[model samples]
Target: MRECIRCGEQMKEGCAIRVEGSATGIIMSTKENAMFSGRIGYPKVAICPKCGEVSIYVENVEKLK
Candidate 1:
């Protein structure tokens, strides 16, 4: 359980949200050049139902590399 930073209320652990890197325009959309381009990151999130606040953090930053 996590605490809401704004409302000081106990927050509930939500689902794992998938996060991916993005680029603007037509830079690159194919997976072939993804290695030299964007990166992948997965962050665990917690939500406060009382205040509707959200908090996101990466449990293992090393995994992003």
Candidate 2:
């Protein structure tokens, strides 16, 4: 388990987490019921436990390559 950056608390898997990504753009059109015709952003990301901040870049996200 890894500790959260904002809260310094342990981050467990299978737990509910916040995700950050682009809004009305290309990425939005690929999601369920997606209606946008532009690039959205990243698929999804997790938020900070203490500050609840979402941090995830779609363009930079990969399979840990």
Candidate 3:
């Protein structure tokens, strides 16, 4: 376990993806100003070793229960 950046308490990762079977999420565009959807892509993510900060950028996804 690790502490948060704003608070020095035990921090756990909030869900990056909240929608089950959700294909897409928020996107910002300056030139296009468009919102893209209907594409299934569940990106893999992991937690930091020291801080327990989770980020999604990996190439593989793991299922845990």
Give per-residue CA lDDT, model 3, range 1-65, as digits (tens). 43545445554443354556777653332234332332223444444556566655423223211
Candidate 2, residue 24: Cα displacement in angstroms equals 3.4
Backbone atom clashes (below 3 Å) for every candidate: 0, 8, 0
* TM-score to true structure, per model: 0.50, 0.28, 0.28
User: What is the Cα-based lDDT of residue 24 in candidate 1?
Assistant: 29
TM-score of candidate 2 against the unseen true structure: 0.28
Clashing pairs in 3: none
Candidate 3's C-alpha runs over 4 A off are: 1-40, 58-65
Instruction: Name every residue pair that clashes in candidate 2.
Output: 25-38, 25-39, 25-40, 26-38, 26-39, 26-40, 27-40, 42-58
Q: Could you tell me the TM-score of candidate 1?
A: 0.50
Clashing pairs in 1: none
Q: Per-residue CA lDDT of candidate 1, range 42-64, in tens?
A: 45778888998888765555545
Worst 10 residues of 2 by lDDT: 56-65
- Overall local distance difference test of candidate 1: 0.63
* Best candidate (score: TM-score): 1
